[model samples]
Target: MSTVLPDQLGHFGRFGGRFMPEALIAPLDELTRAWQEAMADPEFTGEFDRMLREYAGVPSLLYDATRLSEAAGARILLKREDLNHTGAHKVRNALGQALLTKRMGKTRVIAETGAGQHGVATATACAYLDLECVVYMGEVDTERQALNVARMKLLGAEVISVKTGSRTLKDAINDALRDWVASVDKTHYILGTAAGAHPFPAMVRDFVRGIGDEARAQSLELLGRLPDAAVASVGGGSNAIGLFAAFIPDAEVKLYGIEPGGDGFETGRHAATISAGQVGVLHGARSFLLQDEDGQTIESHSISAGLDYPGVGPEHAWLADTGRASYRPITDAEAMEAFRLLSRTEGIIPAIESAHAVAGALDIAKELGPEATILVNLSGRGDKDMDTASKWFGLIDAPEAGRE
Candidate 1:
């Protein structure tokens, strides 16, 4: 319930801080100042609220999952963020940063994406705001998430395929940072996750906390009391933080942060950062990192692009340390099964990231068994993953690689 910063020296208890080069320090400091100013402005608040309602469709509903509830022997509720404009909740952070860009007199936005969801959201905002947008994505990601790549281009954003180490979201981030440093005068980095340097971790999370705010009011209105638990998947931990903020002080509410357990934790092929990771630093945060014994980060694999990260948000690290919330992992197989179940039973196709939460809720609900109520943050729609899912689930049984 405390709004104060945690961790030592701007860290979520050793999970967050600014650890860039000295050349980047001044610009980051300037950004923090500007961000502080914008956040305090009532005019900015007014515009943001209007945009959330008119553009991104704020107040996404908490819908009852009637069929899943019955089968699981507990009432299921879904915070339908999947219905957002970009088919995911990433838009909330992108739009918030885009607004700050305009307010700060910036003319360009640069970002990095994994599956390109954040890139698409940033491009969508730039199109509306008429700002120059550039997205950096892993060359490998460009091949896998080609539709999103095309979508960004169609929105008049330049897409650069990063070819450096890993050629994935992390590499794209490095490229974006280089570009940002080059264009400091005209550009702002719209970080996609609740992980990153100082203000970004807190700022992005604050923007997304709106999810919890709305869900809290809606859940209370419908149930006449808080649900027994709140559940969401954690990648960079934004959606879970968003959905958990309002319920943090609710002592009776159980908060569960689910991570991707690729082929189950024992197989060593999962991205279960919170569940199986050790304390380490990565991507500007010292959170639960999937790292090797030599202190280098490990490769993380997850069927869900959104949840495929080696490190988690700083806030999640603090939560874990403080024991305020519990985190668990859901295997890719389990999540996919939950995805199919939701589609078949509830007529809803959840994002692969959100399906982790669904998979966790299924496990939890059956145990609660006809007594408690559960709400899961359905953070995104699964249409983006349909191609991958079809192959993964043997729908078409594509070749060894999707390209073949």
Candidate 2:
């Protein structure tokens, strides 16, 4: 919980630091200074707070999911971030960075996204702030998350499909960073998650830490104490880190980060970086990454586009190393099953990314027994994932002509 992490150089115990091209140093420095100044300024902070409450719909509900608890064999409370303006926790970081962009006198914002929630959030922020926006998304993700892509377009943001590399989150980041290197003068690259270099890991966490902040107070009010565990799905780890931040000081509150186990560990197609990856540098940070023997980044697979990244935020890497938090993988099948279960039981269709955490929490609930309470960050809704969910669940099958 100390501010010491990310040191003066942005390294989180040899995990985070600028690994970008030299050309980016000046802009990164500028952004860091701007963020610091904004954080220290009451007007900036006040406006940001106002926007979160009035616009992004912060202080999201912490609902007690009684039905879900019965299914999991443990008390369950869900921090419902899915009800945010852009339908995901990504909106917090997007709005924060967008405000910083304006404060820095930048007129344009460029971002990269997977599953398209971040892109949609960025586009929404840009529209609200009257700034130009551009989003880079993987070709595969654009197809799977078409609804979000359409939302971004309707918000007046330009969406570019990056077809390079694995055509996923990592590759989209590659193209976004490339764009930033050339447009740093008039543009700000709103890195979607907490991964990237230096300030991003720290700054994005600060922006989204509201999740944990609210959840902590709500838990005390509702449950009369902290939950036994804080749970969330981790890809670039923004939501997980946000939810874990406020609980870090509570030694009794365990943290669980669920990574995507796409097809299972033996298949080598999962994105369970912290659980199975080797330490390596990727996307400008040293973290646990899925890579080959030759040190090439491996292509990560997941039923959920948002949880399909190959590397995690460096802070998560540090947490895993320090054993302050536990990281595990929930296979795609397990995640999908949870996804279906939540929809049927509670009428809450979670984003497949969040389903990973749901699946993990169920197992943890059983392990900890019925007396324990588990808080899960329901990071986003499944509206944007209808296409993928329909395909996965076979919900689009042809109906009988006279069935009605």
Candidate 3:
């Protein structure tokens, strides 16, 4: 790669821009400059690869899911990022960028999180790299994902709760952006999605492409052919893209991006962007967003913290628009059922976000029959969701239970 900066400003084909206050321009310039150099540096390459292999556990296997296939009626496989060190694909991009932050001489990592998986992953990187970590989460998310909150605290991160707006992911991003503008020095915004401003979609995609790269090679080696379809849950859509990108040029593979439908799509309480969305601007990128008729972003509700955001990634928007990929919604109840079934039947407790993908796979499998192969990106594990799961399943007290 040439690693050259584009004079055209921060854009990925009319999707991303640094649309921010004037005072933030200089820091964005500095960030762009440093990232360009870091990409070109041989020292950074060697170190990043070493850390990926030794610490973060790159090259997670693509396994043939015989049981899932048998039950679902299609031959199924999984690119198991859930097996990664921090139990999520988020760590791959987080670690790569945290290393770059060190190279830029920045000592703090800041990010906005919804479900808190990204926050925990970033905090883990800061712990290893000895950098300060700050995460902004919506107050509602902080309450829903308390286990992840404790995980970040255990990893030495400071979490701030934003009570503004609707107390969800969109508000969290706004709050994080505010913090970024204020503390431009010693702080790199460790964005969780492959969206946001320029350099982010492409940059994060490049870093996390390891998942797809590995899956492609591993699938062929194990199955002796390309899978019929690849599926991943899309919140901000990094995992889906990371896995889908490597298979796009294959031509034989069908790609599906599963978004969270908190309820039914017609019910208005969902995050099914491509399925129930419109073109809108959010978090510095133009993507399919859950917005109202007046263009205000609507609050998306999903049982999965990782998939409760209002926007799909910019690249995903392009893919859906261009007809290169398919996007669909899997409802919250369906996802929870899939999560529990996968655990009980196969001992795999997938992250709720990942469970959405599994739920999609089951539906696809029924249509494809037993001969077709489907590869799902198991984006993360579900251990961080024990509390929420217990409550949701009625095994424990609800937040408002016994409130007579």
Candidate 4:
């Protein structure tokens, strides 16, 4: 929780630091210097704030989900990031990084995505800023999140389908890093998560920390105090870290990160990195990774395309080790149940990734009882998940002949 963390070398107690090819060192250093200077400049900060407020929609509502609270047997305060432009919290990071790209005189931006939210957000930012945008997405994720793919394309991004290992989030990152190495001189890799090497985890966290900042102040206004706990679903830990950063200084508030327990952790088919992973390196940073005894990365599974990753952000690894926060697994079944429950009870269909936190809040509510209040980061909306959700719950039926 020390503000000086990540040290001068970009390490979060050994969990985060650059582990990239020699070609990347210069660009990464350039990016780090640019970000540091931007953070210190009011002109840069003012422009970023204006864009967030006028374009991406900041200070998203902290809604009191009365129905959801009643169903969970606790007071549930939902930080509705889902309402932001592009329907996810990824926009904040995308916009901030895009601005930095412009400041650094980079005219092209490249990104990697799972669930396609980040890709769409990056494309959106590029379109707005007149930068050329390219997004790499795993083939598997592209199929499951086709709507988001279309969204990115419509926003003027060139989308490439990665057909490499596992064909998911990790593979998308693998391909994106390859592209960065070749094009670092003119292209900026707007990493979507609070992971990757050095400045990425720290920079992405700073961009999205507004989520926690707004929620914290809103909590004080509504509840007269902080909630008993803050909960969010973790894949690469962007949203979770954003929400957790502000609350870290408040010792009374507990933080929980829900990981994807695809099928179940016992089945060896899940993305529950923090819950069931070992220390390892992946995608240019050391973090908790799902790896074999020989250190080969294992393929991860998840019902939600976004959370299907083999490694977690380094800050999350540090938080888990330090016990300042707790990470738990929520199975696909559990997440889906909460997904449907929220849609019905609160009329808000959350992104499947966010449903993991909703499911965890249900369990936490039971533990803390009805009197305890909980804040949940509803990180994204579910419009892009209609295809998967419809199939999951059998809402789609076989069409009758001539129906079209």
Candidate 5:
């Protein structure tokens, strides 16, 4: 199918643009040109495909969820991104960008991460390519996602804890951007998701489009046709975009992006950008942003560190506005419940971020009923969330008596 989006100037309607410091404009344009040239080169794409197969583990499984399907009253199928090399879909973009960095003759790679999956993936890629790696993470996130931080460090990345702003993902981005500005000549900022400046939203999405490409073919091969719905969790929205890209022209396939509803959007405690946000510029892209009356970005909260963000990808905002796709809020309680349900029913412990999609699929499945088939992107594994999960489910005793 033909695709028509993110027009010549890198806009998904009015949502995406080069809204950044003047200094970043030239670099972004250069990167965009390089990416376009590489995409057109058969040898470049061929090598990328080879790396995906030999290293990053492309073509992840599409598992049929028998018990979960019965519970949801629909045929639930999971696109198992969690089974990838670094236990998440983030590796796809990481390896792709790492190769691009090498092609551009950059020596070091830098990145910012929330739950640390992207940091781990970037670090892993740098290690594989023998490049220097640096990862910036929010101080709060570092504490909660300690395992992933250790994993990044183990992979030889120098992890920096940003103690600014809300001490979360946004702050990490701020610091990473500053680092990139100073070290652009030798460093490549591996923007983790499908957000940020012009090329980033497009570049990262293209790098990871394999998710949708594979799932589309796999669905037809295994189920005789495409799925009725495609559901995935959205923070910066890379995974969701990657899964949505291949089906954009399939009018029969519905797309749903699950945002972190946290306590509730009503309480002003969630990261439900599309559901409760306005068009504003943040982290370069003009998209649905959680902000105040004066347009200052509000701090986003979510039990899942990965979903704690105030802005979404520009393409998602365009998709919502154009009525081509929909976005829904999934609260922490609902996400955790779905997390446990999947573990119990399918013996799969999905990351809390992915649980949002699982919960959303369950909700959608109810309306669609048994005849419809739902495909949910199981974005990552829950191994890194054992501590948080243990606390939430009371699986372990508190450190101090009556701590709560």
Candidate 6:
């Protein structure tokens, strides 16, 4: 509901700042100015709105999972972001950044992605806008999410596999940032999530804030009121922020940010940054990050590649500190269970990242019972995850021919 954040110095209550190299500062400032101008200009905003409606397909569905509702003994509603054009909510920010890249007269756009959804979304926007697109993804991710890699290449994007560090999202970000610094004059770096420096955390959220805006209106129109709780998985916090922004002013609605609790939190193998991390700087922003006592960043682990990063959006840190929103960690087993439950009960195969939210909602639903309502942000479809899901559930092998 409120757009006030990252005040003059880009500090979101000490959680966010321009904590990057000197070479990056000027470009970030330029991006900030361009985004400010775009936000204020009706011509730009009007065109963006039109593009989202006509091309990107905004106003994604909000479906009531009647079976899940009955099973959980509470009304469960799903914010169907999985239905978006790019098969995820990443398109919103991608399109916004692509528009800015065009307006800035940049010849190329670069992005970093972990799960490849953001890279695919960026590639799609670049194709639509005729911009040269380059996406840097971790070597490991490129192998695991081969489907998305091929999708980006099909969209005419050059996908570079970074073989550095842990060979995951963090490495991808490092490579993308290095590339941006070298090519800042003729290129725009489209950071994938709402966790980057300054304008990015705020800008990305503004672009995807429609999730919460529409969900609130839809809930009121269909359910006759707002939901008791709003839940979303927080991998860099874009979708969660988008779904929480419009409800921030509504004190009655509770916001739940679910982080990946790989294996279990006690096993030290989770990406539950806000839940089990300390304040630190990572990938240009000072936020809650998984780190060791020596101040070195710790590699985060999660079955869902999308949530396998150590840092989160700065606004989330602010919200958590202020107690305006609660952060929860959903374990890998819990998320997998929810993934199967949703697929069986609602016939919707949610992205693994989204299943974290479903798991959280199921927990809350059990506690709140029949009268409470929960809204879950089904962030992406599970088509890209079919391989992983099938293997995880041991369904990769065909059934025995004689089995009944």
Q: Flag regions of model 4 displaced more than 4 Å.
A: 399-404
Look at candidate 4 and tell me the lDDT of residue 336.
91
lDDT per residue for candidate 1 within 183-287, as digits (tens), equals 888899998989877878888988889999999999989999999999999988889999988888897999999999987888899888888999887766678
Q: Is candidate 1 or candidate 6 better by TM-score?
A: 6
lDDT of 3: 0.85
- Model 5 collision count: 0
Off by over 4 Å in 6: 1-3, 398-404
lDDT of each: 0.87, 0.93, 0.85, 0.93, 0.93, 0.93
Candidate 1: residue 303 lDDT (0-100)? 84
What is every candidate's alpha-carbon RMSD to the true fold? 1.9, 2.6, 2.8, 2.4, 1.3, 2.6
TM-score of 4: 0.98
lDDT tens digits, residues 210-246, model 6?
A: 9999999999999899999999999899999999999
lDDT by residue for model 3 over 203-257, one digit each (tens)? 7887898999899889889888888999999999999989987877777788899
| CA error at residue 298 for candidate 5, angstroms | 0.1
Clashing pairs in 5: none
Give the per-residue lDDT of model 5 (tens digit) for 1-404.
33667887779988998788888888888888888999899988999999999887788999999999999999999999999999999999999999999988999999999999999999999999999999999999999999999999999999999999999999999999999988998989999999998889989999999999999999999999999999999988999999999999999999999999999878889999999999999999899999999999999989999999999999999999998899999999999999999999999999999999999999999988889999999999999987888888878776732211
Over the full model, what C-alpha lDDT does candidate 2 score relative to the true structure?
0.93
Q: Candidate 4 on 1-404: residue-level lDDT in tens? A: 58567876678887999888988988899999999999999999999999999998888999999999999999999999999999999999999999999999999999999999999999999999999999999998888788888888899999999998888888999999999999898999999999999899999999999999999999999999999999999999999999999998888999999999998988999999999999999988999999999999999999888899989999999989998899999999999999999999999999999999999999999999999999999999999877778777878785532211
**Residue pairs in candidate 6 whose N, alpha carbon or C atoms collide under 3 angstroms:** none
The parts of candidate 2 lying over 4 Å away from their true place are 1-3, 398-404
Each candidate's TM vs. the true structure? 0.96, 0.97, 0.94, 0.98, 0.98, 0.97
Model 6 score (lDDT)? 0.93
